[model samples]
Target: MTNSELAVKAVIDTWNQTIARFDSILDKLTDEQLENEVAPGKNRGVYILGHMVAVHDRLMPLLGFGPQSYPELDEVFLTSPDKAKATPPIATLRTQWKEVNANLAKYYAQLSADDWFGKHTAVTADDFAKEPHRNKFNVLVSRTNHLSYHFGQLILMK
Candidate 1:
């Protein structure tokens, strides 16, 4: 494979591994446990989970897949801080998390190495021409770091 293809594979693999780590941690926690704050006066497990789901769902439209499957989550999870608005049930958030990631995986699978370098919806054509690094693949790289950051916080709950 070309260097570009290998680079894309490496990023995709890291993203998937980070996702699996979250799944493993979530699988072990109960609804009540998820309600507890990760730290004193800090965000709860449910809040983090919902936040992650909301962020990943937005990636759908950001990457040109389609509109978010759960735009309602934006108010509670994305725009607001923990407890700023009522969140959905842990069960519902869990389902949404899996569904959003699964759908995104499908879209990711469809992209070729060249496609990964294509401009995402958020960037203008003129800007993309000038700043080629702001591509779909860059979004995945940043979100992978985002996921890993929260995953570290989530681990504290266990």
Candidate 2:
């Protein structure tokens, strides 16, 4: 395989592993456990999962991927200004996580060398505003890093 293929595979593998860990974490939580907050100002399991789904759902579309397509959960909950303030049921949050992971995997599997190397327009006026155009490779790396950071938070919450 080429370097680009290896890079893509590495990212996909990381995402897959993270999803598996997420599944395991969710499986161990009972309904009541999901609602248990670790401490003051900390989120419960349901809140963490909801935040994860929201971040990914929003970023995916901006990456030229799918929409915020997990319809079973309320859009307001996923995109609410106060995401940390609300916690849906454990079962519902788990279902949404599964759906988001599946969608993400599907998106990653469809990436090609050009897809990784091509330039994409940024939807925000922040850091990327200078160029407003980023290589797909950078976008993938950034997205994975963002997810990994949040996964660390989830693990800490557990």
Candidate 3:
């Protein structure tokens, strides 16, 4: 494989592994534990999980997968503070996490090497030509780090 193709594969692989790590961390928590705060004055595990769902849901549109499935979660977890809004149940968040990640996996798997190097959501085709570094592969790299960040927070509730 070309060096570029190998790089895309590596990014995709890292993202998949990060998702699995998130699942494993979450699986160890009881439904009751999901309500516990990461620390005093911090958000609960449930809120963090919901935040992930909301963020990944946003990624769908950005990645050309489809419209976001959980726009309602934006205010609850993304915009508002953790305690500012009522959080959804763990089961609901868990299902959303799975569905969104699964669909994203499908989307990422379908991209050709060229597609990975192509412009994604906002940057125009012209702009992309001028700045090839602003490609879709960067999105995966960024959000993989994002997932790992929150996954660490989720593990703290254990």
1-158 in candidate 1: lDDT tens per residue? 99989999999999999999999999999999999999999999999999999999999999999988999999998888999898788999999999999999999999999999999999999999999999999999999999999999999988
lDDT of 2: 0.67
Provide the lDDT at 43 for model 2: 62
Poorest 10 consecutive residues of model 2 by lDDT?
A: 77-86
Tens digits of lDDT, candidate 2, 1-158:
99878887787777678777767766776777766664566666566667777766665666678566754344545545434344566676677777777787787678786687665545344544555346667777777777777667666655
In model 3, how large is the Cα lDDT of residue 46? Answer: 91
What is the TM-score of candidate 3?
0.95
- What is residue 38's positional error in candidate 1, in angstroms? 0.6
The candidate that achieves the highest lDDT relative to the unseen native structure: 1
Rank candidates, lDDT, best first. 1, 3, 2
By TM-score, the best candidate is 1
Instruction: Report how far off residue 62 is in candidate 1 (Å).
Output: 0.5
Comparison by lDDT, 1 against 2, better one:
1
Q: Better model by lDDT, 1 or 3?
A: 1
